[model samples]
Target chain A: MAETTRASDPGTGTATPDAHTAPLSEFDRDTAVRRRARGEFETVIADGWSVFGAVNGGYLKAMVGRAVAETLPHPHPATVTAHYLTAPRPGPAVIRVETVREGRTLSTATASLTQTDPDGTEVERLRVLATHTDLTAGPDEVRTTAEMPDIPAYEDCVGMDLAPPEFLRDAPIVHRLAGRLDPDCVGWAVGVPSGRAGTRGWFAFADGRPVDPLALLMVGDALPPSVFDLGLSGWVPTIELTTHVRALPAPGPLRVALTTRNLAGGLLEEDGEVWDSAGRLVAQSRQLARAPRG
Target chain B: MAETTRASDPGTGTATPDAHTAPLSEFDRDTAVRRRARGEFETVIADGWSVFGAVNGGYLKAMVGRAVAETLPHPHPATVTAHYLTAPRPGPAVIRVETVREGRTLSTATASLTQTDPDGTEVERLRVLATHTDLTAGPDEVRTTAEMPDIPAYEDCVGMDLAPPEFLRDAPIVHRLAGRLDPDCVGWAVGVPSGRAGTRGWFAFADGRPVDPLALLMVGDALPPSVFDLGLSGWVPTIELTTHVRALPAPGPLRVALTTRNLAGGLLEEDGEVWDSAGRLVAQSRQLARAPRG
Candidate 1:
């Protein structure tokens, strides 16, 4: 529930709250609550049902990263394999974490999310595998074929007036974290901040919204055509999505580079990396999606 | 490879020399491996690929499982998610287990398998997420939708007219683990005796050749049509496979029950569960596949 205070206390139409704010920044609000708890783990069940509306992809991705941060060991980073069970509607849900085993160097926990229904069945389950390390030499021969595209910056590219539907007006989480998108700005995400080894990167929405990792993962499969120089209108729907998050960035700009290794008649596979401003590879995503018709 | 003794040699065709010397009963093989490794942890890669086969799913699954097991603390059960990056061929591979973090009750480990290639471009990366556990309580409404199906015994199911494939006959590793399958067998599996908590059932080819889990995963999805009375002519190819191994079952006489949910507009989704004769749930698998016209 949200407070009913807006600029339009009376009748000025111009002072009215934005329609998209009906469920404005619930995750941000929730985090504000959790921050007060000294960063201990918390759970809020998703109780209502509605389309995610205009939340940007990157913001959703950040949500997932936040989820991982909430459950993983503090200070030590984690690599998580997340599978989207279904699109969640804005509501409340409870997340439970059970520490499986704890060792000197490594630990494991299982997080299960059960959606509250009158019938009471678990709708989704997430298993995260995290490793703790002080520091070590990483993998060698790290090569990626994704070349950064020449897109405009956030400031110069705004106000091109390419808007979508009402429900989707500025709701995507990606745009919020990366920064306001200028029309000239291509949907490129860089890795996370500096001093981070392994992978870290920045990601934002083409249309601005808050950045959430879950959204990026939800739409990471949508990059084959864009990565392969094909139009988004031509690709098939994604059947499965699998993302590997090595580490989180220090919070900054995001650049995404996509490359296609195999694309046949109807089936296609693409790999993408999310980079932050500091050029650390924050996250990597791979998916098997259907290639839409040209 | 196996030593070829003459059929006329006493106790040759019936069982192997070890079996002749210490006559392994059906239960002996079932419980032998399980008893040997309980409470204590074994360094699977310490022996370094001594017992393995090229391209078999069972060998791959077990090898991967053992890799994860080595990283776990003594006597902790492990549940692993092995993602197949590429098809493994015959050869030597190394399984490295690193402790992530150890705690009082639970612990975790990161296990990876790297196959050395002659070309050496990209070594096939098999990553396993493993964990160990202690006491846990779960008296909730425990129910599984994976219903058992009616099938003939493993011996009755094998046709006398159909000679088993040469690969099934010749592989030493396969011959050692052949009792794992029965005619009334629920599904194709390859597994060695765990000699610990329970049996570990897996998928294997008839030719004593170890089958890949992906291939067995395909069967898990395909059989639902037959099990659910869809009356389809041929097996359907899987479009998506999602599997979760809740617990390990012993290596022999595993039962699998597949239920088809729908076959509409060329797409199908099947739900399945594998159980032992003791009526315990060992594994759960679900698949989304395209039903081709038989």
Candidate 2:
């Protein structure tokens, strides 16, 4: 009972990729993005693949959204932008794709993810820029003027246990939080606060797999930064990111919200939303970080 | 009277790039992103440089942040990510720069902006991924748990005059609305709208130019989108865009909101906020549009 999987457990949501609880070979060896054979599309970044150590810009933007969803024929991923040039180390990474407008319905690619050196020479790090479509028809015209924050019903919030390391302590992303968070962002990230700058609850992954759209594009930088509740902390990284899926997420436990109003100078801006336990409003995100240096 | 230039008229905040207000040689020839002599940094996608007619992913991420602020020695542009790959049609758009991860303090570049097909072959359209720092120090720590959205002060908003042709009705950015918006996304958008989406006020640049951080990166896609208040209209392009500058905005009228919760399938997600009329909170954006098709 991953906490009794809720929102009435619609469709029983099954992600079907269990090598042993959603390992799907680290999403096909380090997050879904493929195309290596010396043709730009690699991933190995495994050495903790961190969050406070660096290597979690949504798991390298799901390795550039599975390398722009394998050069898009169309499976859905409408947008994904990542630009975190520095802080990237674990090992073996190369994702140099670039199609830029593939169209049928819609497609666009640009994957960089470098850092191969050893005379193999690569060294870039983050530059995912994407867009792929086929959102299952759905929009002739739909409407929503922004409204999905009224939380407190993921069985009534509050439940978090994050530690990262036991080989990522079973990483795929599975935060239940909502006792109002921001103890310096998931610092034993407890929960229960929606006063405003943000935090809403429940998200699934550690093998409970379900949400898709490239794992909701790694759940939009996977939380912990609503600018650490204004006091400012360390390892804030994440230099650039953009995600927008809009629909195709409705399984179990997805309702997330991680907001931020703004932070200047050292620059910080964050915003996110993901509603799915049948609530709809699938994905939306915002990023730009820098704080925790000197 | 530029409508009394508000927020109690702070320092008369005028960016002075006049040729009749921030003409700025069209941002050094098509949006502040220079470096061309056939070396490889270019910009020419003009012919109305659209917003609904296409070609405005923040003016191609300010032409990849003026070509990564001319290969980063740092003049500022800490982050700018654009990923639109379609709707490109107005000519000579080349911006191929890639200096990923350069750091003395911070620098990351990756401009692709192509579209050179006559016979030579290039075709890329958009992919500006940047981060260049040295924003003149001054950040050891700052605090602002997010708060700045109580707008409607800029002379009380509502003063728009859009035409979209007088060579894009003089576009170098200039909008003023807060008389409560959605007039059809800054309206004068002319006709059709009964749905509901978003819109907010006060933004400047029509040579008013006094909001730097690269013009707050073109005021995060310079308005006219909230999906035309859901009645749904054309030119909602913007395939992907990410901007986050945060603070440096202080001159005059700056307090924008522009929201959109979700618009599913045809896919839409817009979120923007810029508040600096001495109010603080400077640049934050989100884009992933596509709702003008059928």
Candidate 3:
């Protein structure tokens, strides 16, 4: 099964090596891979998580997510909002956490990710505000309400086409985007504007690691801006993004729905939902980004 | 106009005192109403903003928004996320900011709002991660794309009925809710479940203060959880909410569109778009809140 999903690495332009051959346990092992001492959490971003030049925001989020989650009694991160301060290069980073109110039902905490400068000043990297809670025990109001949209199976969606930017093309992950009748990224990928908005797709690591909560964040925003389909172009940068982890996804290619409801006042808002293959909604994210210029 | 709008104070239930007597500029006056010393941004959350017990989240947000925006070269609070740590009784609060990265075009900063107890130990109150940018100079891709759903004019919409909760009712704000042939939070008011899920309204302060960007934040989340209409009942506490200030809202009763896209595993996500009376998309917000339970 992995063989069929196997393909050359577009970002590296290399015969996609079985670099994904690492065990699936690495998802948990790598994301929580941190050490704490003297009021700070520190971690080395292991290999294979870069999108283009910087580390994937989702993976970075997982690092802080775990660090902060550990500070609270709740085992599940109900809400986590990470503010990218300075995107640090994949490397040794420091996370300092402040516990706000450690309630029995819910715990709210904040973490700051930083790296030391050569001059020894702690360079701040990211600020994360998270609420951790025991999902099953939360106020006892559980229901699966929004039915998953009837999206075609992973095999039905198109494999990533004309790669996003040169940077995102080389990621060490695999993606299966939804097939769209409209043109994709023509303004940037091609020379003309496709003049539509929205991009949907499924994603999994090349090595077949099932997506955990952290990876879902990465995969959720990792898609090309839906605006690209609209024929608008440029780097559509994420100004602020908030993700709600609905449930730890069940294994397999994660199916996702992505769209921009409005492109106004020089900004576009992307609304994305991630559904596990089991058809359960796993996570939902909304990001505010600048619309790419024509 | 003030006499006409200044009819009742729902949340306070006071004989609508001269309290609503202050000009709407007081919202701005009370929010940015700050003092900075020793690298701390401080302000008093004046009276009149709380819905029931604590200050409204949107009002709290504007306080931080103004303080942080004042610290940045860009005066606009482009993106701001506030995680309620522990609700502080309206009083003096201190905001300590950490400059994330002050780019020429955009500046990212994080602030921790704290209030000192009688013991003198500062209690961490709220965490706000904000991006400040010059709204007018923002990428310049200005284009109004999404059309506001045509609805009755402000006067045509019924004045708020079936007040949201005992807490939101009797507040100084006056709400002109869009009358729904479908059931509303009236169930909560009448001790019955409405068995539907949706709420839309027009709102402005009782003193005739037009909604500003800061006030818009409050009004955006002010409506009863569309969930109440769904028959689920309990406090739908906001876990985390992110709002984009697409453009400074024009003065008038802001039209807000609110709905939860999905309610899975005890969590529901509310997507809200706030359009000015002029029908321009001024802001959009998505929040993760607990599903209301009976």
Candidate 4:
């Protein structure tokens, strides 16, 4: 089967020549930040991460997470919320971080990403607030009423590259990451939407870099808008997104489910859940976005 | 019929002398903000709004919303996310608002609430970011895959005052707002818990005030922690909460459903949806909070 072959192909599954030997995966390199001052860092929004004409909201959030994690005493982000002010293009940007408060168990901080235009004007693209804590220090007790979506086996799912959606064909980020869309949820990909507002899929870095707490921020908003399944095809710009990292993901492809429960007043809310290879819920997210234009 | 009686008693259902004659409802009077200057406002954290020892998270968010709405070009908060830093006692506080951006369709602002101590120390309580717009100007179209929970009728549910739990015996907020708990989901109130992490309830001001967009912020976090259903009964301090107000609710009691799906690493997330009296979805929210200490 073409789907099974694409899932295992070394070129697609592991983009790096040697996953174990690579110093930094493409994701880490693209989202890398350099400390310039006490609370300021410099980074670049690399090319090929755009969904339509703007950088992915989750990718921008990852940059904020990296900067925040470096400044706070606690390393892992427990909860992060980012508001997209302007769609940032691929270019040099600066991140300004501020420590809001430090508590016994958690520390809170706020950060903003801005890009300078040739006119010397700075444009604020994203503003974020996050609370950080050491995940390892948490209690071992685990209790959950959440369950992962029932997706087909890794090899049975349809690869993104197999029959690329019209809008996703030229998007480089799709190639940088290996993803599979559950056949049941991708009816819209073939011009016959299931008339539902949900999507289930699998995700992993093509280079095989292990998923971490920081990467979970990216995974939260990485899926296509669930509205597409309802035959609403257009760019659904996110107004705000909030992510809660529950645990460190185990090494393997992650399972993801996205659902839109309400669409009203030209806006919709998308709720997502991500589970690790071990079938443990790793993160949950909710985002508000504009419905596709009429 | 104790539950039914409590739900309609004049003292509990409508505490005010006259719903129409009263100049201001208790909620508005308590949440009222006085303009101090441009982008600044003064308010008091009224005594009866605390959940335990701290003020309700939603109440605090409503204060921020009021302040932000006053400074921005838009009048209603479309999306608001607040990070709780320190719990402020019932006292005078200051709200500082700043316009982050103003666009044709939306305007974004950030605000902070700080309380002063007797020692002249100013403590930061909450930080918020919000996007505001004229909700009435939005398109009238509506579509939803979400549905209200399968809750009993207003009079069939058990009133909070019918059999007040031990922890809620002294909570003034419970009395200020009349609430009914879904019988099947409130087993934790007694010796036996339902062993689930969900709660459905009906909420309205004890003073017979109409529901609005700003008040929806309070409704989002007004319910008790859903974890109580799982026998995890203690104070769950919210770290952060994000509420998206979809529409101005029709006048009447609001229907609320809260669910906690995953609890891990001493942290849990609660997702809530609120529907107005007209049975239209008005708001959606997600909050991250500490799992009650073992």
**Best candidate, DockQ-wise?**
4
Better of 2 and 3 by DockQ: 3
Using TM-score as the measure, the top candidate is 4
lDDT of 4 by residue, A17-105 (tens): 45467567678889999999999999999886776676788888998899999999998999898889988989899999999999888
lDDT of each: 0.37, 0.63, 0.65, 0.84
Alpha-carbon deviation at B50 in model 1, angstroms: 5.9
Q: Which lDDT tens digits does candidate 4 get at residues B144-165?
A: 8788787887788887767657
Rank by DockQ, highest first: 4, 3, 2, 1
Per-residue CA lDDT of model 1 for A103-147, tens digit only, reads 443334434333455587545423343332211222322222223
The residue-by-residue lDDT of candidate 3 on A1-294, one tens digit each, is 244444422122222235477443445656654555744776877555655555666677878887887677787877777767666776687788887778777788878888887798888777787888776654433345566655565555555543555543665432322222223333435556445465666666654455666566665577667787676755676666678887766666666777777776677788787887677788888777767666
Candidate 2 lDDT over residue span B1-294, tens digit each: 244442124335454555664435333445644566533675676654453345556756776677677777777876677776655777777777877677777777777777767798777766677777876674745556656777655555544443446523544233221222423344425555545566767666433446578767767677667666665666677777777776566666677777776676767777787887676767777777776663
Q: With candidate 4 superimposed using the best TM-score fit, by how many Å does residue A148's alpha carbon deviate from the native?
A: 1.1
Please, what is the TM-score per model?
A: 0.41, 0.32, 0.82, 0.93
Residue B207 error, candidate 2, Å: 12
2 or 4: which has the higher DockQ?
A: 4
Q: How close is candidate 2 to the true structure, as a TM-score?
A: 0.32
Give lDDT: candidate 3, residue B171.
Answer: 54
- Model 3, stretches more than 4 Å misplaced? A1-32, A116-122, A139-145, A161-194, B1-26, B29-32, B52-54, B115-122, B143-145, B161-196
Candidate 4 chain A, poorest ten consecutive residues by summed lDDT: A5-14
